[model samples]
Target: MSKLFDLGLMVRTYRDPLAWLTLFVDLLPIIAIVFFGWKAIPLVALYWLENLVIGAWTLMRMLGTIAGNILNLPIMLFLGPFFCVHYGMFCFGHGIFLQAMSGNDQGGAFGGGPVALVEWALGTAPHMIWFVAAIAAVNGVFYLVDFLILGGYRKTQPIAEMFSPYGRIVTLHVAIILGAGLMMAFGQPLLGVLLLLFLRVVFGMALNMMRRLKLDGGLPKTLDPFADMQVETG
Candidate 1:
């Protein structure tokens, strides 16, 4: 609990420019919440969309590590499709839940699948295409810089890449879903929207710090299942 609102953690985490880029991406939803008059549905939809973005980048990270080992090819071939189908349905089902909560289960939009969910989500949030694109761009930058150029893949395995996102996603969304529920219960007030934004940014900071600690081999045992893994020094 004390760790959740750790401002010092955020200060250290955002010292990296890439972290600032992540913050920028995370903050984009605020524009709709403020100026464009978005409510919980759009905000949560944007986050659900961002999860797909995260899955896309995670898949790339898995692909990036294949050259590091021969065994990884089979693993990648198996898990790549597995992650796509599983994560797609995971997000799709979550989208359907959000639609049901928002009082919409129309056959055309939420009826189809992930693509339809994406379209429905973007339509719900006015000018959300740009926000979603911003998130994808930040993810692309991180992949190019941290995963590729910084040789994150050199020290990483497909399995680690596969499971790392779940921890982050689950940690962040529990609070998000709770906040959304409260916001919806209260008639979607502006204060609720802003609190949701703050909650996401704070959770992002926490997860990013944990990620850095994992990379540098500084994460405590409680937080470091991959503690046996060493840091990438090259």
Candidate 2:
């Protein structure tokens, strides 16, 4: 009991530094989108949703240490789109709301066309460059956050002291590339989300497993397997 209590404290403390870092890192893309001049609101919206989901996941992982709300595969899977849509709405609505408040025509001048997009892109090229730079600079936010969150838990154990949430995100890019390749190869994008969700679950489970085995050094051999199984698997 004392051991468990101490462990919990360590995990919580380790997450503190990470939380501060994460808050700062989280602001970059938003700054990029706004300052870089959003060519299409949807792209900006995507970044916002992506950032939000990552933040939520980080928070949940921290809370899980004591609360044990360890998100299983299905929850992350379902929440992916929900998070995206939620963030999209938030970004777009905020833009429109501000525009309306300032007395700009509700649906003025921005036509939907490559030419318009290109023109907007050219106008914001410098801003877009800054946005891209910001993204590159802060790309490691997720991994750093994950590492700090888990590092908190490994405070006393043989557990790996560092793991990056961003590291796991590699799987996301890989999935996107692979999905795009498949779409080009076979001409279907329907499975992209499903594949991405599958990868997220597998990646999450792998991280947890690594933490358990590499970081925490696995369950004690003396601990009864049957009882442990009952606790974790039952």
Candidate 3:
């Protein structure tokens, strides 16, 4: 580990085009909200969509980590099916709830029965296509930032290194949910949007700090992946 933080390195790294693009991708949601107006998109729906996307992404990363470290097999065995079933139900249930809240008639789309319920649940995919695409783009940019800019290939970082992204995802979701709640309570969704933008900036900084710490070997050598699981499950 370096005795001192290298400010020069930080400055030079941030000046790279990939770094700039990463920042832009990180800020995309805020930019979109500002451009379209806060209420133009459904805040709750967007948050739920992000939850689904992030959950799936986390599962994929966990599987990749497991592939690299056979010792992680036990954790993978437990979590793989768990997350799939949990997130599947979570997404479908929440999608239906949101549709109901918006007064979208799913029954009419599928002839009004239990079959219709199943159809509506499955139908969330089509409805979420654009939001899912936007989130996938953001995640793709983050992957580039991790691999190309953040020394992911320099040496194998611990699975715990994945925590930073997970933390950011959770934080963004909470900020949006709380902000939207406040907006409804006080009739100021624009204020909520501004709050989300501010939180995104803070989240970006937090991620940068994590990357720097990893570079400096300041991060723990091993962190219990179970701890991460607890955070997600709780």
Candidate 4:
């Protein structure tokens, strides 16, 4: 463990092109799969593995104290499956819902039917709760790590700061939910989803522009890089 700690410190101290390249390459096959479909799973898995390796390396570098990693290991283990199922349903159900809303007759595509709606609600419920929890957990770990490494700021302050992003994220999530509910109430959930998607896309682009300018923190400051990447590539 001590040896691994030394390695991670080394990586963090000296930025490596190979590490960044690995990240990019690891992400590339996943993109290709999105375009090409299941045929790319093998390559996708390969890339994912490489990405994990890079993540470990990067984590080691950023976190000198094993305490951060020790804490992150379990939460991340759970977060992996949590995000997979929640996001999988989020993607699949929301897609179907939007399609149905568009008058495509995609039954329960976006929770169109009562049964589908129930399933969609169930799938997203945990994420609604755990997303906040995971953010808190991660922030706690980072707080400890940062405190141990740099010895700056009060211990609790970092944890609070880390969770600050979630407050905004929760707000956006609520807006999306409210918009979706209004759509369902007005008997146009599909239209609501489509509009929501459109709003998300536009709002996302605007946020990206803000980030590029380092002008974050306002009405629409929360930016999910994953979401941005998806929109750009998607």
Candidate 5:
């Protein structure tokens, strides 16, 4: 474990192109927040939409994993629908909570369904679609270039792919909650937003690194990185 703390191993994250792409996608919102005057509410909406996209692509990853390994079929058949229903409700409930938080005297959590969620998100700041699109496009690039072209699916299991999005999701949610607390206490939205973004980027990269190091003799084969919530199954 001491070797895992090595500075060189951590700094090597800078050399990872995929990691850099992830960072780029994660940080683009800063530009929006700084130059375009984005607030925490719209940023929250952005992340909510990003969660949906991640869920969508995770399903694709599971399919790709199944395609690579026929043995994953049976479990995929059972777990696939279960994951959909569970993750959908999870997002739906979270969306309601978010709408409530940002809602006015009209009331909170008054949404009918997913359509309402999307409407609420876009209603806050329509321009966020561009950020959302950038996120989706970047994720698609990873799906195509890393997972497909590089045969990442060949190395990973369906179970790992299924749990993949949760690490980032949990990390961001925790950061948001902390940032929200800080903002509420200080009444400083800008400070909250900056801290939130910083935490998100650091934690996101760390989680991905932990994952990379865990699978297929990751850090044992080579020195690697870490995260607050280590989603490393291996």
Candidate 6:
């Protein structure tokens, strides 16, 4: 409701240069789609699909860690790094897959066949490493803004705090999909991209409000399950 559209909060949230840079990065895919037409669809699909997959992976790890802690198990400690590495590999794999698919579809320099696809994938594999690293680097900045600047960690356990970005990714992806579908149905792809961007900003503001409430210890009782858990564990 009103909490989701707090303009004041939105203004304050994006005041930082890092926040603005993150938003700019988020807008790049939409820009590509608008300028490059359908040729950019595969790349855009790859980008968001990677986010969705990694988000799901992160969510699983967070839930696993939370459950392990609740049950007094030690396995969660070992899972942290394992899940991170697995997520990185998953991103790289998707990057290669997208490259192969796009190359075959284009059928020019890449040609259309298994061998061409294999060659393209091999040649691009090293670049995919850099691509994955760049994604991690951007996400690192987001983590810093969310946790340190916004004080997200002050409001919840590390596992729960880690869940926030994944939650945002899933929500933003759904918004973009729905918005794009409606726009395409009406033959208004540009409008749809604009809608996607608007929804992202709205959702981003809502998330910031939630985080602020948590940091201030003002979150509703029912929504604050980890508060008591922290007290018990500490």
TM-score for all models, in order of appearance:
0.83, 0.31, 0.60, 0.28, 0.84, 0.51
Q: Please give, for residues 1-234, the per-residue lDDT of candidate 5 as tens digits.
A: 333465765666557777788888889988888787888888888888888998898888887887688998998998789789888888887777777778541432353567767777877764788888888998898788757886777776777666667655666678779889989899988777888788877766664555345443553321112321243334
lDDT of each structure?
0.71, 0.38, 0.53, 0.36, 0.72, 0.47
Q: What does the lDDT come to for candidate 6?
A: 0.47
In model 5, how large is the Cα lDDT of residue 5? 60
Model 4 steric clash pairs: 8-60, 8-61, 12-61, 96-109, 96-110, 97-109, 97-110, 101-190
Among residues 3 or more apart in sequence or in different chains, the pairs in candidate 5 whose N, CA or C atoms overlap within 3 Å are: none
Most TM-score-accurate candidate? 5
TM-score winner between candidates 2 and 3? 3
Better of 1 and 2 by TM-score: 1
Q: Which of the two candidates, 1 or 4, achieves a greater TM-score against the reference?
A: 1
Error of 3 at 232 (Å): 17
lDDT by residue (103-167, candidate 1, tens digit) is 77676554576677788888886898888889889879877876778777777788767765665
Error of 5 at 144 (Å): 2.1
Model 1, residue pairs in steric clash: none
Error of 5 at 155 (Å): 2.3
Q: Write the per-residue lDDT of candidate 4 for residues 14-38, one digit (tens) a residue.
A: 2533233323432343333345432
- The digit string of per-residue lDDT tens for model 3 on 133-203 reads 76677666655565446534333333453342344445655775777687788897677767766776655
Give the Å error, residue 223, model 5: 17
- Relative to the true structure, candidate 6 reaches a TM of 0.51
lDDT string for model 2 (1-234, tens) is 122235553454345553334344434434544565433232322333343344344434333333222443355455545544554444344433323333442354244432333333323334444443343444345334333444432232111111223333344446555655655677654444345445544443333333333234444321112222223433
* 10 residues in a row with least lDDT, candidate 2: 155-164
Taking the candidates one at a time, how many backbone clashes does each contain? 0, 10, 0, 8, 0, 0
RMSD of each: 4.7, 17.8, 6.6, 15.1, 3.6, 8.4
